[model samples]
Target: MTLTSIPIALTIAGSDSGGGAGIQADLRTFAFHRVHGASAITCVTAQNTLGVSRVDALPSAAVAAQIQAVVQDIGVQAAKTGMLLNQEIIATVSEQVAACKIVNLVVDPVMVSRTGAQLIDDSAIAVLRSHLIPQAAILTPNRYEAQLLSGLEILTLEDMQAASEKIFELGAKSVLVKGGGMSGELRGVDVWFDGNACETLTTQVVNTPHTHGTGCTLSAAIAANLALGKDLRSAVHLAKSYVTTALKYSLAIGKGQGPVGHFFPLLLSDS
Candidate 1:
């Protein structure tokens, strides 16, 4: 029998007790793409589909320790960060990045949840813009987050393009502004600005309420694809497809908004 080595991807994010978004989604997305996932949790969020009720951040030292443990031993090919809510954690992460020099960083600027709860403090926006965005290989921000980062209302596709450009100007080498939250039939169009040209990644919007963890999943899936030796564009394409597929088979679990079935492809259907 022959055994092949699976590449590792690290996720530095908060924990969602609901097992829907944040670290849980990241791990599942990694598994789906056949990549090993290591996690260094920045915070533990207390909430479900309804909304994020509370968030308790981990100490800077502890966060650094987790990243160090993974980097010094297990190692990682690529890393994704979601929900780094404070400056201290973000700064600590930046220091670790300089120390480890792990390439292929996908930063999901998770400022607010889908339910409008503040995942990050307003003061830390500057920290993220100056520190984290520059350190990332790619920045994935949704429409609302793009607006928050770029200070532009992403009302149309053109606005998304402008926002992506603005975000890149803020230091993101590459930017992908997810169009899921935008009103109207955009087909969940996502705009990617790679510092030179704009690429539109469009997929039919799935009519599923189980849309939580999508940003986390996309970022994680992109990391997984990168670990498997795929280039940036291919990685984003595959990640988008994976997220769409996951949403199509999402399980309606919670009362407010459930989760997309991470292992949906393996689920046995009644049909």
Candidate 2:
């Protein structure tokens, strides 16, 4: 069927009251790509650039209702999920994705914090692996998260490839093991693996401390590109480039680590 307006992308995630990450970052990235953005917020966090002060998770029913509301009327072309805080939320999300038949799904396994802390318990990780991840078109996990999901410590490029392969075996169509948290030379490199081939995707690394929501932005950009009709590899490639450029213009808001400038081009022109 032929369409008229811009493509739509949906993000099921927690709400970052700070507006640096979570649903806030996802929507901004969608807008940057000219995609209509919708969201189903699973949890609410009282956070800022400094840190998360508190968290309040929505009921599983409420989260599912939001997804139903969006898919029933708005209809997403591609969707992504981040920060499903627990097993109930994970199961609810998986049910909705299947009911809606959401094929272009990006799963950012937000099980570990950027600071290398585990955010979810072992039970939640197990639930995510068994329920939510198998529905994903692409699974995007940072090094620490990759270790948890794939049961392997990812310290080298070879380890990243092996983890990607292991995660791919869990039924995701593809897997991307993000190496941003790796130290030394391995940092900022990512390994992408589908069932057939493994590829390394690299971009000019932007040296900046103001990177609060890099992963969310990258995955959201990939979903937007998917909605815009890009193939999976091209979508990931373009998303990485977008994140790199955004990092070059990362914002210096609040007192701690700030957010990447989602509208860097516009902000630069306005300046």
Candidate 3:
């Protein structure tokens, strides 16, 4: 098989020492899609499947330098931002993204956890909303983050749809309100809005307690697909499928919640 040069996808996010989420998950997802992964780590966390214990953010200048080095040499086709820790990093990332002219940018608003815990401060979130999010090609937020962004409580499918549209007004080209944190029939269903259309995307719900890294994996998969030249909608659809499949084979590692099987194909082949 004659293969062309591999497409490069950049992930501007934090680092998880446990190898469950953040840049680790992003790189895994990119590699799964046969895309080269470049990274600009904004923070580092000492955590495992249990929870985060210590968190330290890198300097905004270092983050900007990393992005500059990657874009200048490797050249990213698509990029995604995960846990940008604070306002300064967020501002720097937004500026660098614009400077590098990264058109295919996916913003995973990692503001809140699945249990409704706020991860970042309000001021940081404000900067993310006003600066970085506006430049996003697609904004992916969870239920709580969606509520925060849209300033509306999301209880039902209609609420999700409404929130998607509301968040779209914040200047994102598109919005996807993830239903991973929802309950009942809406669980694992996502609402997508692109100013023109509103759609609900669903996949087989893989029941598992070990679903860490899901959000990162999903956004990373979308970037990977985009780097591979897929349209936005197609990239999202394929990324959802990939995440659902990975969840089916989620690893039961560590003591608490584990990560999805990013290399499930390899696991199946070995079995």
Candidate 4:
């Protein structure tokens, strides 16, 4: 029997039909971390490990109503947002989050795909910065998302530090600028910056083709850890470690940027 309590965490985001990212990744991460996971999908994407081909957003009111339904009935200790496609959806989510007073919000600014597809529009970025950033407990942005939000090119560690500062200035309680995309020679670098201090998280980057859901998985793991009562910094640290392990154990599953093994530990134990 498991000795852990199942803390509840919610994912307010899009649905990835491929099961590699978006709401799919959130649920798997929650299960992996022993959280009772709940989700309200805001958008649906026809995506695969290969790439995103089509997107159909849910009505903003429906999205808002689903969030209300989940929070009112089941409740969540922590929540994370991924793939919030449009401004209306962003507003709807922010309104509900405010009304429910649900703290511990982790926002993954998923703007572009690794394969060069634009996952989010420029307008959504403005809405995210103006609305969601202030409400979020943590903001997770990759190099490109960081540049778009902070108006700084995150080429070096110094630029990353400045990006974190600008992100916090936009109102996030804490920021995680994922340096997974930093230029040549730096394979592994992710940074965490709280309002008070910053820490650089490094690992031997897994040179694998299967990294499709890294951002979603990392943010969800952090939310799961937070739901389990870990402090923000502790949550981020553990989440980063978890993502690294997941990537290390990844299976090359698709034609393009494939999925890491979200259930690696479970598979290992079953073996």
Please report the candidate that would top TM-score against the real structure. Answer: 3
Q: Give residue 265's error in model 1 in angstroms.
A: 1.9
lDDT scores in order = 0.88, 0.93, 0.96, 0.87
User: What is the C-alpha lDDT profile of model 3 across 117-149, one tens digit per residue?
Assistant: 999999999999998999999999999999999
Candidate 2, backbone clash total: 0
- What does candidate 1's lDDT look like per residue over 1-271, in tens digits? 7546779999999999999999999999998888889999999989898877988999999999999999999788999999888989998898897799988999998886544466678767778888778988899988778888888987899999999998898776699999888778664899998898898889877998778888899999999999999988899999999999999988788788888878986884644
Off by over 4 Å in 3: 1-4
Give the Cα error of residue 12 in candidate 3, in Å: 0.5
Candidate 4 lDDT at 117 equals 57
Residue-level lDDT of model 2, residues 1-271, one tens digit each, is 8557879899999999999999999999999998999999999999999999999999999999999998899789999999999988998999999998987999999999866899988888888998889999899999999998888988889999999999998999999999889888877899999899899988887899999999999999999999999999999999999999999999999999999999998988988
Q: Please list the residue runs of candidate 1 whose C-alpha ends up more than 4 Å from where it truly belongs after superposition.
A: 1-4, 115-117, 268-271
Better of 1 and 3 by lDDT: 3
Name the TM-score of candidate 3.
Answer: 0.98
Clashes of each: 0, 0, 0, 0
Off by over 4 Å in 2: 1-4
Candidate 3 worst ten-residue window by lDDT: 1-10
User: Against the true structure, whose lDDT is highest?
Assistant: 3
